[model samples]
Target: MDSQAISVEILKWMLEVQCKEALVPALLYEKKVRSQYGKAENVQPVKGVLSKRALQVNAPGRDIYGLEKSTEVRYFECPNCERQVAGHRFAAHIARCSGRGRR
Candidate 1:
């Protein structure tokens, strides 16, 4: 595996399953890794708003999690139903929706 590639578990914990102490350092390291790969501009977005680099730029050497502002509802279109599903629940929605024929 490439050294820059993050494991699914780490990525999941960092982005989804909460907890910030580990996330803060992980984000910083992800930035460095992306920079090395020439993808420094967008390692990944924090809540799809600010890029990892932007977060660092906005608050140097501080926890970016503290700076997170109000989050907006994000939706994804379900291919099977042509319905919008909330991002957080899209996985479950898609799983169920995919089994049904399109209306």
Candidate 2:
């Protein structure tokens, strides 16, 4: 094969390998989330004024259970404005605005 053809073949193989590697981890995560939350029937949508205490952000870290902790912190979201504010300031921002709230 010509040099250009050989380079193209190598590039194609690299792309295929990268795609497969990326896909495996994503599929695993999807399966885990589904199994964890899928069985809960009474899960309610978050509502009311935003509270810093109400929000939870899963910091990427290990937990005591030896499981990689999914959620490490909490924050609030505004469903009305679709604004995502982080930390304690989100609560104050929600309080001042008349928008619909979520957590």
Candidate 3:
């Protein structure tokens, strides 16, 4: 394989799911990036804002229960069917659900 092809393969590997979960955070850490810290240690957020991010960013593996729910999965209730869906799939699910004539 040519050098360009090898580089393309490297990029594709980086984009894989497991690769992304590992690589992205490592890259961010290399750059000393942090989602929360310091002075905000005790600042109270608005009622509906993200309050758990600090726990996540600083303590990624604290979910020793090892269940899927223990992961940082975002959940929301669909207003129409009231089905709880993960935040990542909420939009597509709601659209399909509304098309089914329920919402």
TM-scores, one per candidate: 0.31, 0.36, 0.29
TM-score of 1: 0.31
Backbone clashes, each candidate: 0, 7, 0
Candidate 2 per-residue lDDT, tens place, 1-103, comes to 9999999999999999999999999989989998987843675656775544333333335444445665546666776577877765777777666644544
Write down the RMSD of candidate 1 (Cα, Å).
19.7
Which residue pairs come into collision in candidate 1? none
The local distance difference test score of model 3 is: 0.73
Which of candidates 1 and 2 is the stronger one according to lDDT? Answer: 1
What CA RMSD would candidate 2 show? Answer: 17.4
Best by TM-score: 2
Predictions in order: lDDT: 0.73, 0.71, 0.73
| Candidate 3: stretches off by over 4 Å | 1-71, 100-103
Tell me each candidate's RMSD, in Å, in order. Answer: 19.7, 17.4, 16.6
Candidate 3 lDDT over residue span 1-103, tens digit each:
9999999998888679678799888978756644444233565678766546554655645543432335578899999899999999998888888895364
* Model 2 segments more than 4 A misplaced: 39-103
